[model samples]
Target: MEIKVNDIAVDISGRKVFSNVSFEMKKGEMVAITGPSGCGKTTLLNCLGMIKTVDYGKIMINGKNVTKYKDKEKTKFWHDYATFIYQDYGIIEDASVAYNVTLDKYKMNSDKVQKILKKVGLEGRNNELAIVLSGGEKQRIGIARAIFKNATVIYADEPTASLDVKNRELVIELLRQCAKKGAIVVLATHDERLVNECDRIIDMNQF
Candidate 1:
């Protein structure tokens, strides 16, 4: 799989968020988007994930220009091929760990949930409530869900911003593992360690 951004620009309420941004990503690659505050790092991530639109240029995925895709098409693309990991963890606070991973879309079978959970270092915590887990554990559940969906493109926005050093390292390693498994992992981060671990860096300051 591949994604190409060609001289893209975005505006919000008469303000220019960014301009002339271009990048390319291939499967099995991990890319970090870095810049100072107000440089549009998260805005760029939203554009790549199809959640926001660009005011100029185009976004291409696998040779198809997705920038022109309609709302329905964008929704379908997000459902079938993309997933996001947020700094907030994005878990259903009142739900069980297994429920959070599968989100009731996949069967809640013990073996299936256990397998993915184990991969994220949350072994056998399936029945536990997400409300009680640590921030790192909650983030792991977010990654576990991404793995379960087999998403081709993973967009992570400040995924480790809330974690302690140990958990931060763990989350970094887990994201690296996802890239190695052939997913295009793109993240917006200020953490130097996470940025160093990426295969490529898109320094937004250059735009």
Candidate 2:
């Protein structure tokens, strides 16, 4: 899938957060959004993921203008085309790892779940409850879920924040592998090591 953002703008409480932000993202590519704190990287990610609408300009995905998608279409787009990995490592603390990874999707392939768990180095932990995991393990599960979804695009926010040096490299490698499998992987991060691995970098401060 291809994503194009043309002259998109967002404002918060009458203050402009970003203006004329434009870019093109596509499958098999990795792009990093980087900037100082409060530079609207998260806001831009929200817009791209269809979690929020642009105040002005256009957002197109696979030739469909997402700004004009109906509510039903928006829901379907999110369900089948994109998934997000949040900075807070969004996971259900009381749920089993398998439940957290598959959510409510009853038809999800169990082998695929195992494949993703193995990628995150959490191979035999499927039945374990999330609350017992350390912060790094929880974050790896978040990455696993993103990988398992196999969405057209993966929007990740500071995905390496909770990982150690070795796991950080491992997680980033997994995200790159997602792109290699034809998913556009876009991330908002401050880690120079991670950002350096991206195919391209968009500096939010330049907007």
The true-versus-predicted C-alpha distance at residue 88 of model 2, in Å, is 0.7
Clashing residue pairs in candidate 2 are: none
**Taking the tens digit of each residue's C-alpha lDDT, what string does model 2 give over 1-207?**
899999999999999999999999877999999999899988999899888889999999989899998889989987897888888889999988888888954633488888788778888888888999877788778767777777778999998886788878887888888889888999999999889989989899989
The residue pairs in collision within model 1 are none
lDDT of 1 by residue, 1-207 (tens): 999999999999999888999889999999999999889999999999888989999999999999999999998998999999988899999988999998883666758788999888989788888999999999988899999889899999999997999989999998999999999999999999999999999999887
Taking all chains together, the TM-score of candidate 2 against the true structure is 0.94
Q: List RMSD in Å for every model shown.
A: 1.1, 1.5
Worst 10 residues of 1 by lDDT: 105-114
lDDT of 2: 0.86
